[model samples]
Target: MIWHLIAAVFAGLGAAGVGLLLRLVSGKRLPRWIVPVCAGLGMLAYQINHEYSWFDHKQTQLPDSARVVDVEKGQAFWRPWTYAFPMTTAFSVVDQDDLITGQADGQRLVQYRRYRFRKEYVDQVTHQAYLMNCTSRETVPLAGEPPRPRTEATQTFTETDPLFQVVCQQE
Candidate 1:
């Protein structure tokens, strides 16, 4: 976070220097406030760029076996620009190499972990284990200390669901 602040400050300073040079080249025709405005715009541009590229940046950090299952785009009233071009604020990933497949009672089951990434002050990551019944198109989280299946929290998915496709594609 401190590094980002430092970079923004440097970006603002560099833009301000450019504004100053422009004013000098124009023989003082440009107003003095132009430098400060340029500096502010530079800092804002840096912050916007950082936010817009966050999803791709996080994706690049994941392994090749990891598949993206879900994505969430955010738009805020304060950031009106986001409504025009939404930014990915959260996503879910599943790794193919970590899947544990099995068959019981003539039903195909797959055990896997779902990794959820949220863009926050610290870039939060929350993961949960799941037992997916591919044959029935149902999934339930393996919760608790011993991680038993939480049937109450079970969810059913359709064939087109990304999570279901990734977890069942191998079988």
Candidate 2:
């Protein structure tokens, strides 16, 4: 956090220096506030860059074992400015190993995550228990139980108890 502040400050100083240099070259009619205005704009630009790049920055920092399941983008107030355009502030992740097992009871349980995109705010990850039920029509037994052609849909859901909770419930 302090690093970002320092970067912003440096950016502002650099802009101010550029403005001052331009004023010197122009040799006349330069506004005294030009340096301050440029500096302020540079600071604002730094903040905006930080805000917009947050998601990518975070993704870059995650461990390779952590796989991103999904990403959601939306608008948020605060940071560079309250009325700024929308940005991505949340995402979901799952461990690569979790995906190997089709069972929900294991570490592969689906998880939901949200982030507020603030320096002080921490990302939140929540385990989600999906309630699923087998349709009666889908459970019809095969004649003679010889074999059936497998497809993508076939491997997806099984004919287990129609109603089942994915994530275990807290006692």
- Which has the greatest TM-score? 1
Q: Tens-digit lDDT track for model 2 on 1-171? A: 678789999999999998898788888469878989999999998888886787788889776755554566665544435345667667655444332223333333322122222322555555432212123112111122343322333213433322112211211
Candidate 1 C-alpha lDDT tens digits along 1-171? 999999999999998998999999999999999999999988999999999999999999999999999999999898899999999999999999999999999999999999999998789999999999999999999988888998999999999999999999864
Off by over 4 Å in 2: 77-84, 100-171
Best by lDDT: 1
TM-score of each: 0.96, 0.57
Q: What total of clashing residue pairs does each candidate reach? A: 0, 1
Model 1 scores a TM of: 0.96
- Against the true structure, candidate 2 reaches a TM-score of 0.57
> Model 1 Cα displacement at 67 (Å)?
0.7
Instruction: Please give the distance, in angstroms, between residue 170's alpha carbon in candidate 1 and its true position after superposition.
Output: 2.3
* Model 1 poorest ten-residue lDDT run: 162-171
* True lDDT of residue 88, candidate 1: 94
Q: Please list the C-alpha lDDT of all candidates, in the order they appear.
A: 0.95, 0.52
